[model samples]
Target: MPFAVYVLGLAVFAQGTSEFMLSGLVSSIAADLGVPLSAAGLLTSAFAVGMVIGAPLMALFSRTWPRRRALLFFLAVFVAVHIAGALTPGYGVLLATRFVGAIANAGFWAVALTAAVAMVPDRLKGRATAVVVGGVTIACVVGVPAGAVLGERWGWRAAFWAVAAVSLPAFLAILRSVPGGPRPEAVPAPVSVRDELRVLTGPRLRPTLLTMALVQGATFCAFSYLEPLLTRATGLGAARVPAALALFGAGAFLGVTAAGRYAERWPTAFVTYGMAALALGWSALALTAARPLAVLALIPLLGMLAFGTGTALITRVLALAPGAPTLAGAFSTSAFNLGAAVGPWAGGLALDAGLGHRAPVWVSAVLMASALAVAGVRRADGTVSGVRVT
Candidate 1:
């Protein structure tokens, strides 16, 4: 892989930190901002919602611009929004900042994935995607837990400040490293919106998108509520939450690293077994919520399966949609974010119903099972059957 691909991963690490770090800071944010816990949770969903909306839109708008220019622009917006969020006094303004930051984050992601893939050969695309996605897993391992610690020691806003501070270097690195020009010869850039739309709506790609969405939804439904579950049900102290999160992150890193090896050669079996294992992990977590040791044991295994499967599914999307890299990136980004948005909201609904944190784990198990079903199904031609979005 090119050094520039790693630079793009560095950029993703900075931005992806902001995406997952909020789960750890939710309680502090809720307390400081004088909002209900439920409302503070919306901040996560708000960012996800923006990503779901912004991925394709930002990808389309920036398609004509040089890749370097588009990346820098998005990172600039992301840094600005984080700074604004850190300084905001009102919950509504902070909420708005999360949404804006996500749009910027989504734009960065859509472009970065395309750029990363463009730098490599077709056989290496899966590893390239893993390299980029590995940044996110690394963020979970380092950045998210660090943000939690910052929130615990200073305030929730400190976490936001830290994100902006760390992201600036990534912005500068990307400005220096990524080349400016038309799309590389390895991939063809879309010429028009209609052309991209036609490729996006193709029969082979939609089921991959659906499966990606469901896998992400299942993983995050349990993840978004992990802090609460650990503290309330598993009897862990607040100080231990970051460590637990770190263990999960470590598992995620390992998972992505391991799965990337087989993603290209055995995409179907990788996704199927990964999803089945993840569903079982969630079921086990729900069943053992009261046992601290059991909960800890399961966290990393679950994290491993969750991100491992995610990496494979995304690799599959890139393979299937080679003609439309930018839109393909956008669609994959949108699919995952769509799930990220709904998972938290659905988990919140479980809490609202007085079902407790364990309910969300059960919810995740069900969602993962559905994803397994999708991954397991195939047409007579041995292709994954695609579903139309409309």
Candidate 2:
């Protein structure tokens, strides 16, 4: 793996910290901004909405730009928005800043994933992707907890300031490590809007996109409410939630590392088995939420299985649309964020309708099961390219 891959990962780490850190800061934000908890929570939804829209839009706008240049631009925007978020006067401005920040965040992932794969051999593409995506898992482990602590000790604004500070180094690292501009030989010929749309809408790619959405939706359904579930359903103290989240992040890191080893060799089976494992984990959580030990054990297991499929799923999309790697990557990002937006909304509805904290667990299981079915059927039919799908 090139050192550049890790540099890209550092960029991801900075952006991901901003993205996931909100989970820990929502309460403090609500209280400080004099808004209801539900209103503060919309910041997350706003970010997701930005990602869902921004991935492809930014990719389209930056289609002619060199990967490294695009990355730098996106990171600059991301850092700017975080600074804006830190200094915002009220909840509305902060929410807007988050939305804008996520646009940059989505653009960064779209460019970074394509750049990482470009730097590696075909066989190591999955591993390259794993290296980059590992940043998100690390953010869950370190960034969110630290943000929570910062928010508790100081204020949510302090957490935003910290992210802004961290992003400056990541931007400098990328500026130094990444190539300055696009290689003339490496750039693809100009693609039309119709051609790009066709690539994304093709039959070979749709199943993979749907599977990505389902798996992500399923994972977030339970994951978005994990802290409350642990505290309310499992009787864990609020103080212990960070440790539990760290455990989940550790499992995710391990899962992604393990998946990288097999994803290229067995893309279909890798993702299918991961989905099955996720379904089982969620179901077990639903059944064992009252058991503190079981809840503790299951949370990490869920995180592991949920993220384990990342490499394979992205690889599958790249394979399906070999002609348009950046667009495909952006579309994959969009699908994942679509799920990210939808899952929590659905979970919140279930909770509001009188379903207990355990509702998300069951909701997640059903969604994962649905994803498993999609992958299983596609595998059986040999629809997707590259993999035997057997």
Candidate 3:
């Protein structure tokens, strides 16, 4: 409900949209740039690699700045990076620009997650985090679809340009509406690096991170190559890809809101059930492409389940490492980007092998199944104190 939370959410929305819209546009970009689609998709990995590297770096460097300034600076970088991505002369240049944008993204999410928790009342932090984090969910629903449509109608370059255009206003919104750095201390700043390691390496932190890797990886594995998957499997045209993306995004939005509302009562089981649902939905999705309508119908349900797990996961981490929530949140964000990086890279291998289109989705189902197993393992221990991670 606070203005800061809303602006934080908008920043996330822009980042999330940029992160995902590429899937819908990859095919077109590949064609435009005279490259393979697999190679085009690799740009996502390049960006993700930037995030993976930038996460800890931002955590280490930005800890000293006023949190609000750190965020605004990143948004400025984000706008610059997207503009570069749009105007680049070659595919390689585009990837480099996106990589820089990805670094900005890492800072945005890291700060946004920590700020959301600090800005809200203790009892409401979970929901507040969800509201802020839901930017990604909304991105899945609106940003991806819209970007894809724009790319299809105009060109993929248009998508990146649009993302850059949005960043200016988002930056202005944060600057005007959010309080600056040296805001209230969320908690006593610990001995920055040492305390961060202690909390991150502590008991609750390890498994929760593992859980995040599995769940987030599984989602990316299926989703990174999703446009090709649907096109190949369902014989859908380029124009329809955005609509399919919209379906998945719609489902995720529902899943996030629903999970956030209920997660406080039974965090572990909620994640457990959500993982189970993801496996089922992914399995169903992989096989249902022959029935395109049915496949499209199921995407939202899949998104709802696959993406909703974050609400409980982040809340759990904050609970376990109350004093060290920022680093924990950073780790989780890194895990998601790591997953994003790996999914497409691995899927590209399978795709390169001349495997049919459904391979990535099928592999994603297996990944989801593995994620479920990991969730069960965490549940069995009952030692998980902080976040659920995935």
For this target, which candidate reaches the highest TM-score against the unseen true structure? 2
Q: What do the candidate models score in CA lDDT, each in turn?
A: 0.86, 0.84, 0.78
Model 3 C-alpha lDDT versus the unseen true structure:
0.78
Cα lDDT for residue 205, candidate 1: 77
What TM-score number comes out for model 3?
A: 0.89
1-390, model 2: which lDDT tens digit per residue?
A: 888899988888877888888887888888888999989988988899999999999988788888878998999999898888888778888888989999999999988888888888988888988888899889888888888889989999999889888888878888888887773324566666678789888766887899899888987888888988999999999889888888889988988887777888877678877888888889999999999998888878778888888557877787777667558779988988888888888888889999999998789888888887887777666744555543
lDDT of 1 at 250: 93
Local lDDT at 89 for model 2:
79
lDDT digits (tens) for residues 1-390 of candidate 3: 688787888888888889878877888889988899879978877778988888777866677677779889889989988888788769888878888888889988887888777877777777777787789888887888789779979999999888888777778888887777573544345445777789887766677777767777777788777888778788889778767877877877777777667777777788888878777887888788778888888877778887788567777776677656457667777877777777766776788888878777777777778876765666566545544433
- Superior candidate under lDDT, 1 versus 2: 1
lDDT of 2: 0.84
What TM-score does prediction 1 earn?
0.92
Sorted by TM-score (best first), the order is 2, 1, 3
Candidate 3: stretches off by over 4 Å: 27-39, 90-92, 181-189, 235-239, 353-355, 383-390
Give the poorly placed runs of model 1, Cα more than 4 Å off: 27-34, 185-189, 380-390
Instruction: Give the CA lDDT, 0 to 100, for residue 379 in model 3.
Output: 57
